[model samples]
Target chain A: MHIPDGYLGPTTCGFFYAVMLPIWAVASKIVKKTLKAKQVPMLAIGAAFSFVIMMFNVPIIGGSTGHAVGGVLVAILLGPWAACIAITVALVIQALLFGDGGITAFGANCFNLAFILPFVGYYIYQALTYRAPAISNRRVLAAGIAGYVGINIAALFTGVEFGLQPLLHHTAAGQALYCPYGLNVSVPAMAGEHLLIFGWVEAIVTALVIKFLQKQDTNGFPPKTCGNDTVGLNAETTNGRSL
Target chain B: MSFFKDSVFSDENASKNGFLQSLDPRIKTITFLLFLVQILLTRNIFILLCLYAVSVLLACFSKIRLGFFLKRTWVFIPLFSLFIAIPAIFSIFTPGEPLTTVKIAGLTLIITRPGLSGAALFIARVVTSVSFVVLLNITTKHFELLKVLRIFKIPQIFVMTLGMCYRYIFLFIGIIENTHLAVKSRVGIKIRPKKGQRIVASNITSLWQRSYQLNEDVYQAMLSRGYNGEPLVLNNFKAGWQDWLWLLCALTIFITIR
Candidate 1:
């Protein structure tokens, strides 16, 4: 979920940015080492794919539609560290260019969607599928569950962030300076919707895409090793070239 | 799709020979960040309103249509922030001196004074911040904005990735548009929900495959052209006296407000 400006106090925004700075640094280092010279094109294409994935609205109940974040899917294909960088780049473009998210809140949004979502989703899928063949039904199921749990976790973090605002920032008279909802309201409101509707959308999209890619028997669809190898890039450069 | 294409892909407003358009994008970006910082720090509603008015005036001076800018900024407020703000005005959430009372079938609701003021302040902050951000975006070319990231010492590779991503997003969007049209033409706009999801998933896979292929091709192309891993960027940002004057004025306003 994209957090807009003014929803969180400046302190909260600053805190997230401080937290994300190291994570971003680590991610870039890992991606650079893993993908090397190929990191540029691979990450660029991944970021573009991540950006455009949000545009595909899938039909839901009652003729409504929802879009998938595709963070987990990207992680499955490109590894979590690369997914983190790709999604962060996409979020940056969204904030700076389209105004889809707030510039002030960029760090918070990336922490949730870029960091938490992909890392949690990828690991969960890894644990579930552990050593299973890539084409197995279990892998598909793992992806679905991973998507659902990943998004719900990210949403929970967002809720906690929003809920904390009232307690953290307020006037002398107890008037909220930012988001007014306490944990009781924000948690349920955010996590509940995702749990019921958006989570299922994410799950279905992830599972179906995984199934399709598996059916196509695409080589290196899900890299055997996560951060250790670059999967979808040129094979010769997979060992990574020296800068 | 048209809305996405228009709002994002079209840089007509940025290309216009307007005030913000003429300034160095790096300078404009920094000044806008200053405006956002001021907007975030202030709790005073009057100050928020003043900042908002200044954003509006900036938009006008930048040759942005007042109606278009207002609609673009306010539309997000209602969708993202208003729902939260609405409950903030009620006595249940923001307990304080009652400003007004409302009665429904069997209940009385008290809108607290503090609640109203807090809600108004939150709305003002959101609007002002969104205005400045929207203003900055609409008045600066997307590539220029990407280049401005270099000012923060973001790694050149990361910035280059971002630039390439921006360059290809439109191409993917076009592919998505064509795919949607092809799907609609065949499915006649009434595909079953499961089928619709299947189509979407397939399209996503198709796009990912295409991107993967293109990634290899582009990397090979880069290698052939002597890319050598380090991307060189043309630094053409020239901040004139007017840009410095604007920065000085912005800094002064920021300090004065503080």
Candidate 2:
């Protein structure tokens, strides 16, 4: 779920941007480490794929269409950094070309989906994979849950970030922020709605894509242990390359 | 989804705040983030209402239609927040001062005030937050924004993808649309597409395969053009008079509301 600009108070967006930019800078370096020449186009194309897939309202729940950000799937195929950048780029294009997310909220949306998806989703994936067979169907299940959980976590971050807005003024003015809707209210709703359904879809799609990639392991980037230009990090790097 | 709708949300009064388009995306980004965090911390209804009102006014200044925003946001965000509201609705056990309660089979089940208050609070927070998000999306561009991010040294790898994804989103959607068109042209009958969902599914699989191949070709073309990891060099855009004025105005109004 893209958290557009101007959604929260000025101070809130400002603060969230402050926290997110540093992580994003780190994300960029992570991207550069494995950015072989061959993978550049794939990164861009994948970003585009993610945008369309996320925004393409699949008619579900009786004409109530739903779309996903394709975060987990991007993480699976392209590694977190590439997926992160790709999704960010896709989001930007979506914002500029179609007016999907806001201009001011670009940072917020990118932080929520692009940064959150790949790193968090990938980490969850690794946790699941570590406990599973190297190439078992259960790994697919793990990928699904990881995908689900990663998205929810991102949504939670958005809620927390959103929740922190009024607090900033108090912080700025040396007072206390109010708490009308406790973290209990906003955080859960964000996790449940923006992320939950997308999580299920992401899990399924991520599982299938992972399964598909597991079969070929050719068209995508090579594992890092391959240790060369050809050996771009794949989905597994999400665990703890900790770049 | 219409893939080019975001360009519409750029400032309607660009004549007044020209340099907002030129500010470092990173700084602008951080500013909005502060907005999100601050709003979330506020438990005061008065504060929330003030924030919500300011958000709406910003949209109005952008010259966007309120009806349009309501139609867009209410449809997805508010409508869906019912999930949170619904669950809280059932957890009502506290006795109320004759508050509205559901009765069944000569048994009266009281809807507690606290539970209802919780639900209302949940709805209000979600609506306000989501509304602001919609507002943000309505006002910015993705590339310029990401470039702002690039200033923070966010990797070119990720930036590359954002650019690619934006370009290819439209391309991929085009493929889907064209494929659908071709299918429609051939099907030419009274059969509902739903009845032939399996056929559509198979077609999608093939389409995915073809798109993959097409994507590879597109990559080759990019490389042929000497494409590197970095797609576009981050151009410098100075924060001018409008940028300062806009920022000051926003801050002043925000403080006043608070």
Candidate 3:
């Protein structure tokens, strides 16, 4: 999914970066509003978690192994802004440090996985948890299904983005190259791969991580780890200040 | 690029002269993106070498260390192999000319010419892009990078969530670490649950509940602070001449090369 550099034609790749950078900017401002200072390090560690956990390469059925992005879990714990930025940072670090993704294509990868997946997954989870009669066997089942479906849809969007490349790069001479690998074969195949494999991997891991975070901080608010917030907050408390 | 960030920001490297500590986030971002584009514009072996040289030179001038760049490649090589190999390894068995033949497990292992070519293409692309991004982080602060995002016009809701998450990520890790440590101190890494799957299930359910509660608290805090949908703005780091020059260079190369 990380479009390593130079794989896509320059025009297509450049267009994506330009498109995504603004999206990233909007996400950043949202993150600034959400942060209360105390949550900073946890998010950084979350960033680190994203960088490390995605590298685990857990063994599954075939010779291939799949990793989790933990987007839903991050959203549940940190909210979408921090989750997106943290995930973006994690992805950036993964690309720079490990070359897992391409630098030129980082915005594209970030757009698909970080921006699209978590936000979509969060709302779907919320919608399911709320609309359903109860968190019964049926509701949980529905929530799981919705989350899974949401992930697949995001995957489909990514496939389409990748598929548009050859079409956009279409020149008279490049048409012959299509005979061996037409757009028909590539786009749906990539989408199908995501829907079947990547989505499932994302769904299960996300569900697990979300479930885990919910378990540990049973009080809902995470423990305080920053002194600035506490000092500033406590000072206000003592001085009888209120926003 | 990787080396530049590691030397300045890698937890341990902060002690060195913080040359990159004060650059405008927007400048760092624009340069980083352009540098990535520069790498992407080349496929010829000579151009790849030149791209690598340019990135290295930039890092040296910026005073970021060489070690930071190489340290990150450890995670990439293995992970990248998996990324490219699935599609690539599958292509080898499609009845093409065998590039190499080997015997294993009483069967012949074949690498086809097409598969070999595909792998080469995949590797080259991965290397060229990853290297440039490695440079970006080495030269830029993560927070400043986020500021750059806001300036670039990404959604405020989205950025706020990411930034708050970054701020609080450590708190959750500490809690989780303490819990893990407590479990270890008492049980010393038990292989399996004493009961059945119920223990694991219960643990998972508890975690889910906690995460929800945490977000609820976060919402309360935000509501009390007047968080109506408008995103907070840094209002710094405007794009200047360097950005235009960099973009022009990228545009020129992209059009001329292909």
Candidate 4:
């Protein structure tokens, strides 16, 4: 979810920006070094797809519409480091172009959606499907589970951020100047929605895509092994170029 | 599908001759950022209303339709914030004088005076902040916004990635939409979830392959043009006297408003 301006106080926003700067720098360096010059266009395309993927409204049971975040999907296709850069680029573009997220809260948004979601999702997927062959159904299920868990974790962090605002920043009258909700309210409000609705949407999208792709191409996901070779633990490390 | 049209990047108002459109992107970004910070810091509801009125006036001067601008800014974000603000109006959250009371099933809900004021201020801040961001977006070109980010010493890699991404986003959208339409035409029968999943997966896989193929084509094109990996940007920023005057006014307002 995109956090708008005035949601978090200046101090909280600043803290996230400070924390994310180094992570972004490291991610960029890893991506530039591992990816070939030709792969630049592909990475850009991936970032663009990350931006547009949210537009696809998935029809679930109960006649409700929800969208997939596509953060973990990018990580499954590309490496986690590349996913970090790609999703961060998408978030930045969304903030600047659409004002979907806040200008001041960009760092906090990126930290939640880009860094925490993809990295956690990728690692969890790897841990679960470590020994499974790339084409197996279990690996596909792993991707789904990973997507579900990753986004929920990110939402939890955001809930904490919103919940902490009132406690951390207030006027002398004990009135909240920023988000007025405390931990008890904000955490359940954020986590409940994601856990019940959006998490399932993300899981279904991820699982279906992975299954369909594997059926089409017997070689399966991660068509290349560029960055995956360097980070040998990921199970998606097959024989395709970085997409 | 909403993906059929690009709603995020609005350039309809940017082409029009307006005060905000004429301002330097750098100046617009900095001053508006200051305006947002100031709005957030101020706890006084009347002062918040004044700042919001000023934003509305700025929108009018920018020559954007008042209804269109308000709808664009408030339709989604502020509406969502309203739900977040709802709990703040009850005395259970913030202690204050009881404006009214409601009881249901042995539960007492008191609408406190301070709670209502607090929620109102929160809404005011959200409304004002979103207004500034929406104004900046509607007035400036997408590329110009990316370029203005350079003024803040944002990473060049980010700028390059964003520029390239912006260009291909339309292309990818075309590819995706065409695939969906093609699938719809080809399938005469009502498709089940399994078939639907297969179609979506194949579409994504094809798109990935196309992206990689396009990447090779772009690489060859760049190599043929003697281009290096480094991105070369055209710096055409010329800050006029009016831009400076605008910036100065912004600073004065930011300071004096406190």
B115-212 per-residue lDDT for model 2 (tens digits): 55544554565556656656555555545655665665655566556555555655676787777678679888745423343333344334344555
Per-residue lDDT of candidate 4, residues B56-166 (tens digit): 999999998999889888978889899879889888998877889988689989988777877888888888888888888888877888788788887777778888898
Order by DockQ, highest first:
1, 4, 2, 3
Candidate 3's residue-wise lDDT over A154-173, tens digit each?
A: 66766676566546543342
lDDT measured at residue B170 in model 4 versus the true structure, 0 to 100: 76
Cα lDDT for residue A223, candidate 2? 44
| Standalone chain B TM-score for every prediction | 0.97, 0.75, 0.69, 0.89
Residue by residue across A22-106, what tens digits does model 1's lDDT show? 9989887867766767646878888999888888898998999999999988887777888898899999999988888788888
Residues A20-91, candidate 4: write the lDDT tens digits.
Answer: 999999888877777676667767877987887787767666656678898988887777887888899999
DockQ of 1: 0.72
lDDT of 2 by residue, A1-243 (tens): 565433455555555578667876765666566666665566666666676566444333344445556687667656676666667777766654444555556777778888876788877776767645445777667777877788788888878865564344333322223222335566776777855465665555556555554554443322432222321254443232211
> Model 3, range B18-42, lDDT digits (tens) per residue?
5333445566566566556555554
Which runs of model 4 end up more than 4 angstroms from their true locations? A218-221, A225-243, B1-6, B102-108, B184-202
Best by TM-score: 1
TM-score of the A chain in candidate 3? Answer: 0.76
Highest lDDT among the candidates is held by which one? 1
Worst 10 residues of 1 chain B by lDDT: B76-85
